[model samples]
Target chain A: MKIHEYQSKRVFAKYGVPIPNGKIAIAPKEAYDIAKDLGGKVIVKSQVLVGGRGKAGGVKLAKTPEEAEELAAKILGMKIKGLTVRKVLIDEASNIKSEIYLGITNDREKRMPVMMVSAEGGVEIEEVARVSPEKILKVHINPLLGLQGYQIRDIAASIELPRKNWKEFGVIAKGLWDAYNGSDATLAEINPLIITEEETMLAVDGKMLIDDSALFRHHDLAEMRDLDTEAESETIAREHDLAYIQLDGEIGCMVNGAGLAMTTMDIVTLFGGTAANFLDIGGGANAKKVGAAFRIILSDSNVKAVLINIFGGITRCDEVAKGILEAIEEVKPKVPMVVRLVGTNAEEGRALLADADMITAETLAEAARKVVAVAKEA
Target chain B: MSILINKDTRLLVQGITGNEGLFHSQQMAAYGTNIVAGVTPGKGGEWVMDGKVPVFDSVKIAAEATGANTSVIFVPARFAADAIFEAADAGIELIVCITEGVPVKDMMRVRAYIDQLDTRLLGPNCPGILTPGVAKVGIIPGDIAIPGNVGAVSRSGTLTYEVLYALKQKGMGASTCVGIGGDPVNGTNFIDVLAMFEDDPATDKIVMLGEIGGTDEEKAAEFIATKMTKPVAAFIAGQTAPPGKRMGHAGAIIQSGSGKASDKIKALEKAGVRVAKHPEELPDLFG
Candidate 1:
């Protein structure tokens, strides 16, 4: 659910946060046009959801339209952290007086949205927290009462901001909070909230991560999902309502719950096999969904075997077995498959899968051992 | 002798007219939970589950009519926060929310709002409490566990069942088991249930199942080291999970270099709790 810097800035601007005028460009010509409009001094930033864009040479400063075009062309096709840069943001470059970091995120211990500010900015906040430890200031916001004026002032003063900039800083902080809460974002951050030569505050960079469970309520944010940065199998799994994450291994795993799914993956590893992916069919998954999950698992070329484990509580194992049969009929998979069904209707589920060309086990330990051995043989 | 619910507990189901609510309501009643009433907002004046439990328009009316002191919610995620508010407002002391996908923001408010009252909320996305061979509340299958001396608390549903099944095979059964949900924000954490299990006389030993996510496990380990006198066995999943990947559960992710399975396991071992590398080894960790 991570959005590009340009999209985050657009959200920040809507909440009255001051941001440098920028345009997202997909091609060199568009970058040239945007650079010219910004008076030919701009920063070309690659728009990839993953971090470390600067370290990857995906960000460059351009002095003229020609330089902007060249940098955009170079960055547009470059890969940062395995994600190809499809778009570059051309923004007006500003003269900076100082930089600060401001962010709003959920504090798991506090169980509330916490606003954090640091005097050290334009760098990863984790590094700052790890090294200095005393530079960052945090305040928990009451979800019922929200970020108050006093809390903002306290953060501003603690960060050693000049009294002159406190008012503008407060506005930007409030704006950031609104954008974060309004969009159901788990994280909303502005790195280097810079003080310009004119003494005005501007957000130089932005990052936002929306909560997936809350996406049903925010359609606008949901459409902002970037597919290029995501694994194709993951996107397909999401469409099928299956929680799937691609991993590097030989065995593909499908289980009934999140906790059990992870345990299944762990057991596979403990038995000397690696799980290719973690897939959860979730609660109340039917035959179609189960079939879709099986298909998704086999779609990975690296998967040498498949393991299906179900502890049917709300999910009936017989339906899962039927779905496996349907998928085997369609996919005609070459890989070995192991099935373990337990809980409600488990005996019936085992009966349904008795004739299939797969190994059946009575417990997870046996299933993991068998799946690993079969995968190594395959 | 169990922690949360027992024979005297009068249970009410929220969203009782819905598919999940009706199904689990019947399951709970069949498992010997005292069925009192149900609340579905618009479906009042009707009796569900073979004309035994009455349906009311709201929790207030339902609580007043049935004298129900505990509730299990099956409402949808969209209205789940409101349902919690309604349940809390109606003076239900112990509320177990079986609904999943409740937004974190709503839970934050629910947490704050409930803290002001006398309520002890269990989960917004969890399988509810179970006192085996006595009363089954939510979605945990009724047949797997038997009533005995071991107290169990976990952050998963099927994984808990797996552990319970293993314990049963070892001739060990649970006094009470609680699934605290795997959401980033939970109403009851491991420490809360650990303290409860420590106080319950029917429990002799405790078993905990945790996955990588927040620092709840580390904190719970700290609590176990400092507070509890009972012997504890534990298991943590997602050891093979890669960094920055959400492993099924919303809370089961390793972020900011924290919430690693290795770290949680180390903390638990350091606290003198036997840690199992795999779920199958969990039953043997008790010694």
Candidate 2:
């Protein structure tokens, strides 16, 4: 659910947060045109949904329009942490006098949204937390009461922000909070909320991660889903309302629950086999959903074998077994397949799958061992 | 004998007209849960399950009319927050929400609002509670669970079922099994349920199934060491999962180099809780 810096800035601007004038460019020519309009001096930031873009050389300053094109071309061609920079944000460069960190995120321990402020900025907040914990001041916002003026003042004073900027700082803080709650964002951050040469604050960089469950409400935000950042199988799984995470390995894991799916992956690794992906068909899955999940698992070329594990509670094992059989009949998969069915009519499920050309195990450990051996042989 | 529900638990089903609600309601009643009434807006005059359970327009009316003390919610994610609020306002003592995919922000408010009320909330995405052979609430399949003195708690549903099946294989049953749900923000935590288990006379040993995410497990470890007298065994899933990738569960992610399985296991082991290396090995640590 991570959005690019430009998209976050868009959300921030909508909430009255001060942000530098910027435009998105998918090409070097667009970057050149944007730079020319922005007074020929701008920052070309790669719009990938990852942190440490500057350290990874995905961020660069262009002194001229031509240089902007050159830097954009270089950044667009580069990959940071394996994600290709498909676009760049050409922003009006700021003469930053000082930088500060301001952000809002869920504090799991407090079970509330916490606003954090620090004198140190333009760097990873986690690093500041680890190295100098005292530098960061935090305030937990009650969901009912929201970010109060007193809390804002407490943050500003604790961070030693000057009185002249307090009013603007409060505005930015409230806007950040709005952007966070309004967009259903799990995190809304502005690193390097810069004090410019003019002494006015401007957000130089932004990051936002929207909550996946809340995407149903924010249809506009849901369209911001970047398919380029996801595996094709993952997108397909999401479409089917199944949870799937691609991984390296040969055994394609299709399980009932999330925790059990992960545990199945671990057990696969423990048995000297690796899982190609983690696929949870979810609870109460009927034959059709199970079939869809099975096909998604087989979509991966890395898969040498398929392991279907179901500890049915809400999900009936017989339906899962029927889906697997239907999937095998349709796909006619060449890879070896192993099935483990237990709980909630598992006997009927196993009986239904007994005639299939697949290995069966009564337990997860047995299934992992058999699947790994069969995959190695296959 | 159980921490949450027993024979005295008169249950009301919110969203009872829906598929998941009606289905689990029937399953729960078949398991000997006291069937009282149901709540589905605009369907007040109807009776479901062969006219045995009457339907009401709202939780307030359902609670007032049926004298139901507890409620299990099966509404969709969009209406789940309001459902919890309605159930809470109705003065239901214990509310178990079975709806998955509730927005975290809604839960934030729900959690805050419920904190003010004298009520105990369990999973919005969880399988709820199963007090073996007495009363079954939520979606935890009752047939697999047997009546015994062992207490079990988990942040997962089917994984906990796997552990329970493994325990049952060794002739071990549970006094009560609670799934706290897998969301980062939930109504209850390991410590809340663990404290109840520690105080319950029917419970002997405790088994906790946790995953990588928040420090709930670590804090529970500290609580187990400092507060509890009963022996505790635990398992932390997602050990092999890569960092920053959510392993199906919304809360099951290793973020900011924290919530790693190694860290949780190290803390739990240091606190003298026998941490299982694998799910199958969990029952061996029950002693």
Candidate 3:
């Protein structure tokens, strides 16, 4: 649900947040044109979903359009935090008077959205909160009342902004809040809300994470989802409504729920085997979905064995067993499978899988042990 | 003497005609829950569950007509908060919301609204609560839940079932198993449920299953250190989870100073609660 920085800035600009004029370029020529259009002296930033792009040398300052093209050429194919840079953002570089941190995120303890502001900016906010502790200002916003004028003023004052700049700060903070609400964002951040040489504020960098659940309501935002950062198996699993995350291990796990899936992975590790991936078939998954999950697991070349653990409540165990049997017919994967089925229709499910060439167990612990053993042997 | 529901409980199912609502309603009723009525907007005057349960158009009419004391919501995420609001407005005291993906913004409002009332809401993305052998609310598998003296509370649903099953392996069962939910802004929390279980006479020992993400577990550990004298066994999942990635559950993430598994485990251990290294080790941890 994380959008690229350029995309985030676009959304921010719509809410009247001042942003340096920027353009996303897929090639060096496009980047050159963007820098030229911005009168050169642009920052060439590699566009990737993952963080640490700057530390990874994916960001460079260009004095001219040719330098911008050269930096874009270098950054476009560079990998930052394991994600290959497919696009580079060419933005007008501005002189900064000062930087400040501004963000809105959910507070788990307060069970509400809290706006966080800090004098320290252009760096990790966590570092400021952890070390300085007193630098950051937090304001819990009521969902009904929203970010009030007083709340904004309080944040501005806490950040030690000059009285002359308070009104402009108020506008930027309000714009960020508006963008956050408009996009159904779980986290809206503008690190280094910079004061330009002209004393005007501009969100030089932006980050936004949209809520996946609320994506059904926001069609335009949903289309912005970057699939390149996602694992191939994960994308397919999402299509099947299964929760899947790729990992480095020998055992592939498919469980009924997310919590149980993680536990399954942990138990497999405890039994001396690493889980290749985390996969949950979700609630009430039928034969087709379960089969899809099985195929997704088998698709991972590193997976030496597979484990299917089902504690069928509303999700019938027999249906899961049927799905495995059906998937085995199609995929015909050579990897060993260890299944532990319990709960509703479990006996019937076990009976259905009895004649199959798979290993079955009665308890999750036993299933984990057996799968790890089978994997080690394989 | 369970913490939440018993045989005398009159249950109302919101979004009753919906797939999850109808399915769980049938399962719960079969397990001896006194499901009095169902509330599905505009599906009033109809009968469901083989015409045994009455359906109402609104939570207000449903509560008035059926005298239901407890309600479970199966509405979709978008409408779930309003469903909870309607249920609270109708004066239903005990509410369990099974809907997942409710916006945190909506839940904040829902949380504020519920705090003003006498009602105790369980989850917007939880498996609800179950008092085994008496009344089963929520979506935890009833058969795996053996009724006994151990009070179990968890943030994850299937992991809750896994622990209960493990406890069953040790010849232990639960007085009540409450899934306080894994959402950042759930209505009820571990500390709230821990307090309830601490006071419930039917509970002797307690089992707490937590995951990384929020500091709720650390808070609960603090509460256990101060308030409860009950023998507590704890297990935290996502120990090996990658940092900052949502581990299936929305709330199961490890961020800066947010609930980290190692921190929670250490806190629980220091608080005299036995922390299980692996889920299967729970039984031995208790021993």
Candidate 4:
């Protein structure tokens, strides 16, 4: 749900927010062409999902088109937080008079959406909070009433903006809030909203996290999801309709619920084992779902053993046991499995698995230890 | 006494016609929950689960006809936020959305709307709350929980069961166990549930289960340090998880400088909440 700076700026421009003229290029030659077209100084920034690119040398200012090409060459394919720079945004550099931070997010304490502004921009908000908490100004919006003109003015004043620029700041703040609400964004931020030496306001950088649940309302935004940035196992899990996260351990876990998955992983580690992944088969672990789960875990070559933990209430333990037996037949995993079935129909489920010569534990702790031991042996 | 639901709490199941909805509804009904009605857009006026509960097209009509004040949603992720809002508008006091994959943006709006209303939402992607030996409003196994004085709150649903099992082995029981869900922007936070646990006289010691994500755990640590007086023991998961990667839960990601397991553990330790280095040490912390 993270969009690149160039993409975010496109959305911002739609809301009438002024953004620096920029063009994205996938190749160094294309970056040089764009830089030559813009003329004068241009800033070449790596197109990655993470921040701190500037400090990491992924961002560079070029005085000439050849330099821009060189900077783009250095930035292209550069890894920032595991995400490779596939493209670069080349834009005409702005002369900054002042920089400010503006963002909107849910303030849990006040139980309302809050707009945060700080005079010190272009830095992580956490750093600002840790250093000078008082520098950050907050304005809570009443959900029923929405953001109002006065609220924007209050934020503008809190940032200590000069009277001449107050009207322009208010207008920009209102537009940003509108775009945030319209896009169904959980977080819409403009770090370093700069005032140029020419007395023009422009959004130099933008970041947005769209709410995934609201994709139904905004089909246009849903298309922006970049699957390449996600883990391979995660994308496959989603396709299979299983909740999975690949980890760097040996014991592969298949638990019935989210909480159980975490505890299963915890207990596995406690017993001197490392978990390979966190896989929640959800409440009803049917044969198909269990089969999918097996395929996911077996796909991980690091998996030394598998643990099937189910506390079935609505999900009949007997049904889960059947699914495990069926999945074992389909996957034919070489690794040993430690199965624990509790709650509704647990005895019957255990009876089904008891005939399979599979390792079974009467309790979760016991099962976790057994799985860990089996993994260590493997 | 339980905190959220009991025998007297009437329940309405949303997305009743769906596969998950029907399955969990039957389970809740079997557990003695007063499941009076169900809501499905086109399946209204139909019968499901041996025709025990009437099905309605909308939450508003269902709430009016059945007088159901609580709702459990099994709607798909795409429609979850709207379902929550519909239930909230219908005057449902509590809504437990069992649906997962709800976009964080939708929940942000839904949560904000829920905040405006008097209703409380449990999860957009969680294994709902359970008041053991009374009524089960969520998908958790009712039999695993034994009603008593120990209160449990966790981000992980199955982990909550493990904690309950650990406590049960020690002959202790739960007053109320709530899974606040693992979504980044959820309706109820750890501090909100922790405050409720602190106020409940029936609850004595509190067992908190957290994961690496956001500043929620750190906020809970701050609350525990300054607010609550009851004994608290906590366990944080994803210790072995790689940095800058999301775990199973969408909200469970380590976004750059936020929500590290080691940081949260250190924060909790500083705040007087007994940090369990391992899951096996939970029982000892309570003792």
Q: Which candidate's TM-score is highest?
A: 1
Tell me the tens digit of each residue's lDDT in model 3 across B162-280: 78888887888899999988787888888998898889999999989988898988898899999998999998888777787788888888877567888999999989999887776
Give per-residue CA lDDT, model 1, range A24-132, as digits (tens): 9999999999999999999999999887889999999999999999999999989888888899999999999999999999998889999889988899998998989
TM-scores for candidates 1 onward, in order: 0.98, 0.97, 0.97, 0.86
The residue ranges of model 3 lying beyond 4 angstroms of the native Cα positions read B281-287
lDDT tens digits, residue span A1-378, model 3: 999899999999999888999999999999899999999999999889877788899889999999999999999888787888899989999999999899999877887788998888899988788789788888988876788999998887777788888888888889898899878788999988998888888899999999887898889999998999899888898888888889999999999877788888888888889999888888888999999999999999999999999988778999999999999999999998898998779999999999888898888889988999999999
DockQ each candidate and list the results: 0.83, 0.81, 0.66, 0.43
Q: Give me the runs in candidate 1 sitting further than 4 Å from their true place.
A: none
Candidate 1 chain A minimal-lDDT segment of 10 residues: A153-162
Error of 2 at A112 (Å): 0.8
Question: Which DockQ value does candidate 4 get?
Answer: 0.43
Candidate structures ordered by DockQ, highest first: 1, 2, 3, 4
Best-to-worst lDDT order: 1, 2, 3, 4
The residue-by-residue lDDT of candidate 4 on A1-378, one tens digit each, is 778888888898898888998899999999999999998589999978887999888989999999999999999999888888898999999999999999887664454578889999989987898889899998887655678998887887777887888888877898888888888786789998999999878899999988665777888888888786778888888777777888889999988776567668877887888888888887666777777778889999999999988877556788888877887787788999899887779899998888785898877778988998888888
Worst 10 residues of 3 chain A by lDDT: A153-162
How high is each candidate's interface RMSD, in Å? 0.9, 0.9, 1.5, 3.4
Q: Cα lDDT of model 2 overall?
A: 0.92
The candidate that wins on DockQ is: 1
Clashing pairs in 1: none
**Could you tell which candidate, 1 or 2, scores higher by DockQ?**
1
How accurate locally, in lDDT, is each candidate?
0.92, 0.92, 0.88, 0.84
